[model samples]
Target: MDRSLRNLAVALVVGAMAPLFDSTIVSVALHSLAADLHAPVATIQWVSTGYLLALGVTVPVVGWLQRRVGGRRLWMAALVVFLVGSVLCSLAWSAPSLVAFRVLQGIGAGAMLPLLTTLLMQAAGGRDLGRLMAVVSLPTALGPILGPVVGGLILGAASWRWLFWVNVPFAVAGLLLAWYLIPADGPRTKARLDVVGLVLLSPAVVGLLYGLSGVGGSGGFSRTAVWLPIAVGVALLVAFTLWALRHRGAALVDVHLLRHRPLAASASLLFLTGASLYGAMLLLPLSFQELRGTDALGAGLLLVPQGVGALLSRTLAGRLNDRFGARVVAVVAFAVLGAATVPFALMGPGTPVWVVVVVLLVRGVGLGAVIIPLMAVGFVGLERDEIPHASIITRIAMQVGGAVGVAVLAVVLQRGVAAVGPVAGFQQSFWWAAGLTGASVLLSLVLPGRPRVAAPATPEEAREPVAA
Candidate 1:
């Protein structure tokens, strides 16, 4: 990547680290949070649940926010919002207070997630997506690996409040870098927010996400909680589609952009990617604990190989995608991912630790390859103004897909375990993951374009207003 793109990636990634790590890192603290606040586990779970729900609701409106405030200012404002929320969370007096602060934190984080992608893609001007994704994927690839380790170390040595406090430095540093490195967007003084579209879309996303989350502990889709909100959410989405198609350029999220094949295909595959990747994440830890008699820490450490593999693969995948196109790269990537995942499905107690670790390394590479190409493709042919809308659409797809994946896999495991043993149950679940990934392989064929660098914009194109 060139220097400007590199700087933009660095600025965005640094700022993004706070929220990305904030999400997964908190998973380790749930039990302690429950005891310290004298709340039931169910009540305390909202600390995470509220954050995610707030995220779901907030993400759909980011396009309007970006147009109104400009990317650079919006980014800096979001950092401060997150920073203040983090500080309040550290001082939370009770479970209710913590959950409330986390919702605020989630709102800020929701804006940041899709905005980061928009800013980076804008800076690149559609050139070097493959190479740029390599740089952008650094924190993303590291967050899951580091989240547990960082959260575990802090919880081991200090009060659980430190979990919230830990985000302070990253927020501060990210704000500083963004202010210095990110170019100020020329404000679109005439732009107007799509109130009607936002009203319909925001709750639709939240309802769907909430319903998907319910699919886990309750029976999958068979229960009212899982099916009701989902049905309502889908209905709202269809309503928004009708409204957005009418508004066209004024829609809060332009469903019209789905006409772009690259964007549509990328969104589709990201759903499966989310399902497969997260489903495996759920199964891996449980398999280690139930089958291998490993503790939480040991199970997390076992996951290190997959993360390392992903890390090693990002640069290679990006380079290949830039050189070879997403189609060839994605097909091979999913195949590797599917093949690596199968070992877990077939593994017995007699399977060696070294063998599992080796397979995990290969699995990580598949993750690195599959995610970067899919993410990059959505913006491949998008106009400058359409990027923010595309970013929100893709992020929601991946998030919802992941929620559905985790919920589905959990249900599958429950059924499998009831029918057989824990080992057999886990293997069955892993088979589901592998099969889901294989399905993604078929979807990968629809992703657009040949391998080549994106053409740089001329000065005239650069000066044009980035509008729908």
Candidate 2:
């Protein structure tokens, strides 16, 4: 990569890392936060839940906001907002206060997630999307691995509040880099804000996520608390879909992009990937903590092999996708993921730690391979103008799917633990996770066939860049 491209890559990766870090960091600190604030575990859980709900609620608005305010300005502004929220969260006096502040952080974070991809792709001018996405996605691979370790270290040496405080340097650096590195806005068109769509979609997302979250809580699925909001949310979302279809070209998400085979397939695979990846995420830590009697730090450290495997595979995965296409790589990767999960299903309290680590390492390689190519494939055969819309749709799908995965796994774990105990519960969850991975393998079959190599850009074509 050229220096400018390298700088842009660095900026995007650093910018993207903040939210991933926060997600993991907060997980390890949940118990500490609850104890310190004298809050029940149930209530303290909202610190993470609220953040996720807010992310789901706000993500849909990124494309519209980018068009309205310009990507660079919005990115920098979001960094500032996140920094402020992070500082406030560090000083929060109670669980509710912290949750509220986390929502603020989430609003900033939600925008950052989609914008990171959109902006980087825009900057790259579609020259080497597979490679760029791999670099951009490195943080996601690292976050699960490093987050808990960082959180644990802070908890051991400092206070839980430092977890929030730690985000400051990253956010500040991201803001500075974005202002300097990211290109200024191109010519603007007078695009109308999808206020109606936003109004309808935000609550729909929040309600669905809130309802799903309640599934594993005391109310369970049949309770009014669990079903009511989800039902309402689904109704609103369906209405929004109809409304968006009617609006078509003018819709916030541009539902027409679904007609693009590559984008659609990519989104579907993302859903399944989210189901498997995050479902396993929930099970893995709980298995170690609850069944194996590992503490937060130990559980976090044990996951390092997976991260290492992911990091090791990313460059090779990206290069292979560029050579062989997303379809082949994704299918094989998902299959590998499913195979890796089989070991977890068979694991017991007495299972050797080395065996567990080896399984995680294999699982990590599969995960690393899946994410980068799956993300890049969404833009295949898409026009430059359509990239942002595709980005938004895929992002929302992944986030919502992740929420579903977490909920489904939570329910599975709860029931499995109740009936058979923690070890069996984790094993059952892993089986379910393996199933989801298998579904992703099926979904990957629909992705576009081997990508045809583009002819090299001529001097004039290189000089006259296409707008993202």
Candidate 3:
């Protein structure tokens, strides 16, 4: 790889890993945090949920923020905020305080996740998008795999607060590297901030997420508390879409990007991938811990095979995407994922351990094939100007879809478990997960048949004045 590509890869990896680390690190420490803080499970759950909510709320603004402040400055600032939040979380005296700090950390984290990709891809000048996306996605693929294992080790050897503290080095290192390595922002452009659109979009996303979260909580969908916000949120989103279209080029999210076939298909596929991938994420661990009698650590450990599979396939998937096309890779991958999930549907408490591992390995491979290409293909046909909008929309889709998928799976698993035994409950959930994966496969069919490869930049083209 060229030196610039190597540096970009390092930056993307470091930035992406920070959030993934937090997602998993906290899971192991949640019990410890609750016990030490004298908090209930319901209350402690907010640490994760609050962070997610913060992520959802803040992510939509990233495009505007990038344009307003510039990517390098915004990225470094986000890291500092995350570092400070991590420290506050470590020093928290109460559960509520910890949850509050986590939200702050999440705001920073949410911005960084999409920004890193957008920035690096911009720097690459649209060359090697597939390979770059593969590297960037490694942290995402590894987070769940390493999260539990690392969380378990930290819990075993240290206090729960270390989970937050563990981020200190990575954050510091990322900040330093970003400051030095990331190019200074180009000439600042004068653009309207769309304050009115911000007002409409923020609450709409928050309300929608809040309503989805409520579905799995005490209030069912019928409760006014549940339906009211959801209804309002949907209405607000529709209003924002109309308002954005009226404003045309100045709209906050540039809803016009959706008209691009590659981006639209990519976002839709991401939603399905989120549903199938994360829905199963909820069910898989429950199956191990609740039915198979594995402890949290053991379940996390067993899930490593899937992570390994993803890791193993990252380079290959990227190469395949570049060679064949995202359509071929994604459709086949989703098919594999759908098929792999079927064995889990057949799972019982007495299922063999080796069988579960093999199934997860297959699922992991499918996951690898789906996510990398889906992400890369979204940028296809997008002008340099459109990358940021595409990034923000796709990221939001993935996060919201994950949230919705987990919520739906929670309800499904609860009803399934209640109707059948614990083991059977997981099986039913697995079947549902498989169905979602199959839907993703169908969506993959709609992806652009093949992407046109751009020729290597000639010196004239490279030296030509660029338009942002």
- Residue range 382-451, candidate 1, lDDT tens digits: 7788899999999999888888899889999998998998889888999999999999999988775474
**Alpha-carbon TM-score of each model against the true structure:** 0.95, 0.94, 0.94
Candidate 2 lDDT over residue span 140-205, tens digit each: 778867788889989999988899888988888887887788778843556887888888888898
- Which digits, one per residue and each the tens of the lDDT, describe model 3 over residues 86-180? 99999999999999999999999988988987887677776676677788888877786678788888888888988888888889888878877
Q: Tell me how far the alpha carbon of residue 295 in candidate 2 is from the true structure, in angstroms, after superposition.
A: 1.0
Better of 1 and 3 by TM-score: 1
lDDT score, candidate 3, position 215: 77
lDDT of all the models against the reference? 0.87, 0.83, 0.81
Number of the top TM-score candidate: 1
Compute the lDDT of residue 203 as modeled in candidate 2. 88
Off by over 4 Å in 1: 452-468
* TM-score leaderboard ranking: 1, 2, 3
Which scores higher on lDDT, 1 or 3?
A: 1
What are the C-alpha RMSDs, in order, of all predicted structures?
3.4, 3.7, 3.8
Residue 281 lDDT, candidate 2, scale 0-100: 78
